[model samples]
Target: LLLDIVRLKGSHSAEHIRNTTEQILDHLSINDKVYKIITDNGSSMIKAYKFGLSVSDQNFEDEEANDEDSMDVDEQIGY
Candidate 1:
């Protein structure tokens, strides 16, 4: 069910995506009813749902965190 189609004007960072999703769920009063969220393999989407309540995989989270850290370092050094 497509509740709403929002047009975001600014950055599409992980935090922004998470906040936008939370806001939408809250507005619809269905935050607690959401079991899973399906999104593309984009980094922002992955980060936004990485630690979701329904999903529990410490190893996966650690791996993703390490990957993100390395990417940050690489970006800083102009990789």
Candidate 2:
């Protein structure tokens, strides 16, 4: 269900739109409640969702590395 709406002025770049959407998601979905987002097929929305929960490319890379590390640990544990 739609819970809230926000209006923005000026140009809406992908990064800007992502920040605003994330802010709303932050207020609405906490403690890992957020899973997926659905939006119009606008290029800006597509790009914004691509950013995921990471604020920077470096953070995304770090997450990838951590995930790989966890997989290695799992393999060692006979999982």
* Regions more than 4 Å wrong, model 2: 29-31, 54-79
Clashing pairs in 2: none
Instruction: Put down candidate 1 lDDT per residue, 24-76, tens digits, no spaces.
Output: 98899887666567889999999988987343466557768999999999999
Candidate 2: tens digits of C-alpha lDDT, residues 1-79: 6757788777778888878877887787651455456889899888888746534556556768999999999999999
State in Å the error of residue 57, model 1. 15
Q: What ranges in model 1 sit over 4 Å off?
A: 53-79
The TM-score values for the models, in the order shown, are 0.63, 0.56
Q: How far is candidate 1 from the true structure (C-alpha RMSD, Å)?
A: 11.1
In terms of lDDT, the poorest run of 10 residues in model 1 is 53-62
Predicted structure 1, TM vs. truth: 0.63
